[model samples]
Target: MIKSTDIIRCCASPHGIFWLTVAVLAIPNVALCFTERMGIMASVTNIVLPVAAVWLLMALGRRPGKTALLLFPLMFLAAFQIVLLYLFGHSIIAVDMFLNLVTTNVGEAMELLDNLLPAIVIVVVIYVPVIVLAVVSLRRGDVLSRSFLLRQRRRSLAALVAGAACMAGSYLAGRDYSARLHLYPLNVFYNIYLAADRYKATADYPQTSAGFSFNAVPTHAASGREVYVLVIGETARACSFGLYGYGRNTTPMLQRTGGLTVFSDAITQSNTTHKSVPMLLSAASAEDYGRIYREKGIITAFREAGFHTTFISNQRPNHSFIDIFGKEADDWKFIKEETERSDMYDEDMLRMVNDILDKKRAKELIVLHTYGSHFNYRERYRRSEAVFRPDNASEAKVSNRRQLLNAYDNSIRSTDRFLSLLIRQLDRSGAVSAMLYTSDHGENIFDDGRRLFLHASPIPSYYELHVPLLIWMSPSYRQMYAAEAAAVGSNSRKSVATSASVFHTMLSLAGISTPLRADSLSVASSSYKPGERHYLNDHNLPVAIKKILRGDEDFVMFRKMNLKY
Candidate 1:
C-alpha cells in the first residue's frame, strides 16, 4: 500500500511550493529594503524583468516553475528599473567617489561596527515587514517534497559555495577597492564590482598642481574699485546661455550688461562638485588639488592679501574644497533653511548677504554659494501659478530638462537682479564692488546619452564640467583696475584655463601676494595671453598615448559652442 512514487511526488511538491513561497517573500523584502532606502515604486509593467530573468536562468539550466518563481520579483524590479530607464532614463546618473568612502575608511566602518547592536536594532525596526512576511509564509506548511529537496540540495550547495567564493574573492581585493565597500548600495557586493571602476578612474585621473605662484596666478591690484565681490555660482554650464548663443534667452539681463567679461570657453577642473569647487577656490589643478586641499587652501591666499574672508553656502560641506575654506575662514555661515524649505529660494540667501553687508564693513570678501540646478529638478523650481508655456508644446518644449534649466536660469536671472541691487548699494557705500561668479560644476541633462545624468558621472562632459565664470566690477574697482581690465578684450579670446588658474586670478584681482599653488598661478595683467593655464587628466599618460581625455565624444561638442562660461 506504500506507493513510493506517489508519496515521493507529493512530498517533493510541498517542499517546492514552500521553498518558492519563501523565495518570493524574500525578494520583496530585499526590494523594499532598497526602495525604502531609495524610494522607487513598482507596477505590473515591472514584472517582466524577474519573469524573463527566471526564464533565462531556466534556459541556462535552472528550473522553470521554481527558479522563475523564486527570482521573479527581483527580476521584475531590476527589469522595471531598466525599462524605466528606457522611458525616463534620459535624466538619471549614478555616481560614487573614492575619497568620500575611503578617507576615514576603517575608522568609520569600525565605528559603525562598534555600534553594530544599535544598527541591528535599527534594522529590526526596518525589518518588521519582512518578519511579518516570513511569519505568514510559515503559517502555510511544507510546500516542497522530499525528492525535490534531494534534487535541489546539490545545486543549492554548489550555488552557496560559488557565492562564498565570489564574496571572499572580492573582500580579498585591494584596500582601495575594499574601501568602496563601505559605501551604500555598492557595499552589498562588498565593493567587488565598483572597486574596479574606482581603480580604473583613479589610475586614469591623476591630479595636477595649481599654478598659484608666478605662473597661473593672475594679479589684479588696481584701486578703481573699492570692493570686488566674486559670487562663485555652483554647477552652472555656460552653453545654456542665450548670451553665449543658446536660443533660449537664459541670460537676458546678463547679456545686456556693457562691462561684464564673460569668458565663453572657461571650464571647470572636473565634472563633479567635489572636484570643481575646491579647485576653483584653491591653488590646485584637477590633477593635484585633491592632495593639496588636505593642506592649506585658497582662503590662506585670500586672507594674506588683507581681505576679510567669509564663506556662505547652502550645499552640504565636504572636506577637500571650498567647504574646507569655510572652516579655515575668519567667518563661515551656512543655513539649514536652504535645504529644508521648498519656498526658500536663493533670494533669501541674497537677503542674508545684504543684511550682513548692511550691518558691518562695506568691503569684505563675501563668497555666496548657491544650490542652483541641483537634482530633483522639480523641487528646484518655484511653484508656478500657471503654465509658462502654451499648450502646443510637448515634452521637447516643456520637458523636465528644459524646466530644470528654466529654474536654474530663473535663479540666475534673480542673481542678476540682486547683483544690480547690490551694485547700487555698494556704489552708494563709497566702496569698490566687483563680483566674481562661477559654479562648482555644470549639469548634464538629457544632452549626452541615456547612460548618465547630472555632472561628474563618468569622465564628465564639458557641459556638466564646464561652468559659468562671470566677472562684474564696480565702477571704482574697474577704474582702478583699468589697465588690468583693458588688457583683455571686451571679447576676451580664451585659454584652456582650469580652476588652478582661478586661484591666481582671485589673488591677482585682489592684489594679493600669496600663492595658491606655486605651479598653477598666473596673472592676467594683459588679457591676450593664450596658454594652458592648468589642464587636468584623470591619470598619468603613458608615453605611447599622449592623448588628452578632455575632448572625448561626449565632451567635444561642448568645447567650441559658447557655454554660460
Candidate 2:
C-alpha cells in the first residue's frame, strides 16, 4: 500500500492538482444528483455544468486565485444539498424555494433557524471537510511545463466537447429529467442572479395606492348600521374542521352557533399566505396579479363606498398586503408585535375589535387578520385548552402521528372558541353585523399516501388547497337584508368554491356593486356559479385543484352540475 505522505505528494503534482480541483468543484453536484436518484444520463447533464465551468475557467487561465474562486460556488452547492436533504427529505431545491429564501426577512430567518438548527448543524458538520480539503488543495499549487499545459488544454477541450454532447443527448433522451436539473445547486449562481433582480424589482415597486377606483354601486338600499367583519385565518385546513366533516369535533362552538353558514367546498387561492391573501383581497386571479397589485383592493373599494374600515391583525406587521390595503384602513391595529415569539393570541385581536367598534359608524368594514393554527400548532393554543391530550409530538419533535393530529385538532378548537367569542361580542353589540371567515390556505399533515407534511409543496394536493369558509350574520343583519341573506345561505353548499370568490362575495354581502365584480361566481349572488376552480401561485402555471382533486373527467362531470349563470 502507498504511504499517506506519498499519496499526498502524488496528488500535489500539477496534473493531479488540476484534476483534484476539478473533482472538488464537481463532486458536490455529482453527490446531490446521485442522492436524488437521478438517472445516469440526467446526472451527466448536471455534472457537465460545473465541470464545464471549472474546465473552461482553468483552461482559459491556470491561476491559483482564479481556480480558488470556484470553491465558493461548490461550497454553496454542498450547503444547499445538505440543508435540503434534512428539511425537505430530499436534495432537490427549486427556483421558488430559492426565491422564498432570498426574500425571507431577518425575523423569518431567525424563526427558521430556531426550527432548523439541528439541520443547520448537520449541514456544517457534513460540509466542513469538503471545505477544508478545497482550501488545502487551493493552497498547494504545482506549475505545469509548456508541453503538459498544451496536452491538458487539448484533453480539457475534448472533455468540454463530450460534456456538451452529453447535455444535448440527455435532453433528447429524457426531457423531464433534464428539465428537473433546474432544481440542482449547479444552477445556484443563476438563481442568485435572478433573485437579486427580483429583489430590486420588488423594492422599486411603487408603495403608493393603485389610485383607480371601481366606484361600485350597492344593488340593495342601505339598512341599519352595516357591520361587515372579514376574518383572514391562517393555516387551518377544511378537512380538520368539524364544520367540514372532520372526525373530531374541532369546531364545537361553530357547530352549536346559529346564523353561521359553512361552505363545504371552499378552497384557497394559493398554499402560501404571501400569494393567497394579496390575490384574494385584490380580486386578482393568478393570471392578472400584476394588474391587480397596480390597482386598489376591496378595502379601498369599501372605503370608496363610504364605510369606516378598520384592519386588526394578530399577524406580523408590515406584510406586503397589509402594507398596501391595511394602511388604507381608517383604523389599523396589529396586536402581535413580534413574530418570533407567541405573546399575543387571536383572542387579543377581539380586544382591539372592541376598542375599534366601541362606537359604530354608519358602515363599518372590519378586517381581522388572525395567526390561527400556524405551524407549531400546540403553541397556538394554551396547554390547558388542549382537548386532545398527549400532544407533544410537534413540540418534542417526535414522529408520534396521533400526537401531531391531536395538536392540530387542538389549534382548531382554539380557533372555534375565538370565533365564538367574536360572534358573541357582535351579538351583544346588537349592530347589524356579518363576519366572513376563511383561511389564507390549508395545511398538510401526511394525509394522503404521498406522505406530504406541509403546505407549500411543488406538487398540488387536495389537502393543501381545501380550507374552511364560514359566514356569521347576526340576527339584526340578516333581518335587514333578507334577500341577500337568503342568497348567501342558498350558495353555501355549492360543490365548488375558491378564495377568489371572496372579493365578489364581500361586495355582494356589503350590497356594494362594482363593474369588476363577477357576480355569477359570488357566493352571495343568487346567480351563483362555482365557475372553473383554478388555483394561482407566483408560478406562471395555474394549478387546477378541481382536476387534481377529482380527476379531469370527474372535474368535467362536476362542472356540468352547476349552471354557467
Candidate 3:
C-alpha cells in the first residue's frame, strides 16, 4: 500500500494538476450527455474536444496555473448551465434566459433564488474547490518538464483527430451534429451572441417603427358609447382554471357570469412574457415577428380609430418592448411603479380601469396587464382567497408541489373574482362593451415526471404553451353586434387559436377596419378559419408545434384536446 504522503505528492504533481483541471471542466459535458440525450458519437466528441482543448492550453502556456485562470469564465458558465438544467431539465442556454437576467426585478430574483438553493449548493461544492486549487497551483508556480509537455501535446493532437473523426461519422450518418449547435461552450457562446444582437435591435426599435401606421378606421359610427377591455394575464395556465375543466373551482365567479365564450383550444405562440405579451399587443405572430420591429401595437391601432386608449399594468417596466408598446396608448401607468412593491394583487389594476370607465369616453380601449397567478403565489392574493389550504410553502421543490399548487390555484380564484368585478363594473357603466382575456403564457407546476415549474423554459411543456382565451360581451353590445357575438360563440371550440388572434379579433369586435387586420385570424368575424399552430423557438423563429413537442406526453395532450399541432 502507498503512504498518504506519496498519494499527496502524486496529486500535487504538474501532470496530476493538469488532469484535475480537465476533469473539473468536463463535469458540465458529462451532465449535458444526460440532459440533452446525446448520441454515442456526439457524446464522445463532446468529451474528447474539451479534453484536447484543455490539453492544448496546458502545452502552450509557459505557466500552466496562470493560464488556467483564463478558464474561470468557462467554469462560471458551467455553473450556470448546471443550475438551468436543474430548473428546466434540458436545452442549451437561450437568448430569453439572458434577457431575463437583466429584465427580472430584484424582488423577483430573490423569490426565485429562495427556491434555487439546492442547485446553488451543488454548484458551489463543485466549483469552489476548483477555484481554490487554481490559485494554489498559480502560487506554487508548477511547470511540466519539456519532454512531458511534448508528449502531452502529441496526445492532445491525437485526441483532436479522434474527435473530428467522430464528428465526421455523425455528419455522414445524417445527424445534425454541428459543433456550434451541439457542443457546450460553443453553443452557449453563440446564444450570448444572439442575446447581444436582440439587445441592439430592441435599442433601435423606436427609430425603426417611427413611420409605421395602421390607417385604421371605425366601421361603427362614433355616436354611441363603446368600451372594449383587453385583460392580459400573467402565468395563468389553462389546466388549473375551473372553466377549462380543472377539478378545482378556481374560476367560480367567471363561470357564473353570462355571455362568456371559452376557447378550449387556445395556446400561446411564445412562453416568455416579454415575447408573448408583445405578440398579443401587436399584429405580429411567430411567423412574422419581423413585423413587430416595423409596426406599433394594437393600442396605436385603437388610437388611430378615434378611441381614447389607456393601458394599466400591475407589473413594473423593465424598458422592454412591452413598455414601448404600452406607452403608445393615450395614457398608461405601471401600478407596481406607483406602489414600489411586487406583492400587489391584480385587482389594483382594476381601480385604474374603474377610473377610466367613470370618465365615460365615447369610445375607449383599456388594456389591463394583470399580475395573475405569478410565482410566490401566496403573495398574489389575500388570505380569504386561500380556499385551497396549506398554501404557505415557499420552496419550489417537487415534494412541496401540493402546497405550491394550492397557492397557485388560490391566486387563480383571486383572478376570477377580479374579472367578475370588472365585468360587473363594465356592465354597470352601461357602455356597449366587450372584454377579451388571455394569459401572456401558462406555467408549469411539477405536473408530471419532468418536474418542470414556471414558464419560459428553452424547451416548453404542454402546460407552458396551453393558455385560456375567453370573450365576454355585455348584454347591450351583444344586442347591437348580434352577428359578431354569434360568430365568436360559434368559433369558440371550432379550432386551435393563438394569442395572435387577439389583435385582429379585438379590432373586429370593435368594428375597426385596418389594412393590417386579417379577418381569417379574427374569431369574431364570419371569415375566421383555423390554421396550423406554431411555437416561437428560442431563436425567435416559427417552428411547427409538432416538431418541438419533446415526448409523447405533449403529443397526447394536444391530441386529447383535439388541437392540431
Could you tell me every candidate's TM-score relative to the true structure? 0.61, 0.83, 0.95
Candidate 3 structure quality by residue, lDDT tens digits, 1-565: 9998887576556676677677777888888888886788888878888778877876776556766677788888888888888888888778899988877778778888888888999989877866666677789888778888888889999998987888787677667677888887788899899888888888899899988889999999667799999999999988899998899999999999998999998889999988999999999999898888889999999999999999998888876888989999999998878865646888877778888989989999999998898888898999877899999996868999999999999999998999999999999999999999999899988888889878888888888988989999999999989999999988998665466799999999999999999999999998999888788888889988888788788888778767667
Best by lDDT: 3
Q: Candidate 1 vs candidate 3: which has greater TM-score?
A: 3
Clashing pairs in 3: none
Error of 1 at 300 (Å): 3.1
Q: Which ten residues in a row are the worst by lDDT in model 3?
A: 8-17
Q: What's the lDDT for candidate 2?
A: 0.69
Ordering by TM-score: 3, 2, 1
Q: Write the per-residue lDDT of candidate 1 for residues 1-565, one digit (tens) a residue.
A: 8798875454345333334434443343344233322222221112222223332343332233444344444433333223223332221113333343432234323432332343244434433433343344345442334465455555655554554444444455533323122222223333334435554444433232233323222245433324556566656677766656776666666677656777666766666565566666666565564454234566655665555677777655544345555665678776643466534445556666666666556336777777665543333335551122321211221255555455555555555555556555555656666666777667765664443345444345556655666666666776777765664444354643546566666665666664333322443355335444333433311111113332354434644564332
lDDT at residue 464 of model 2 (Cα atoms): 68
Task: Order the numbered candidates by lDDT, best leading.
Answer: 3, 2, 1
- When summed lDDT is taken over every stretch of 10 residues in candidate 1, the lowest stretch is 539-548
Which residues of candidate 3, in runs, are more than 4 Å off? 1-17
Q: How does model 3 fare in lDDT?
A: 0.86
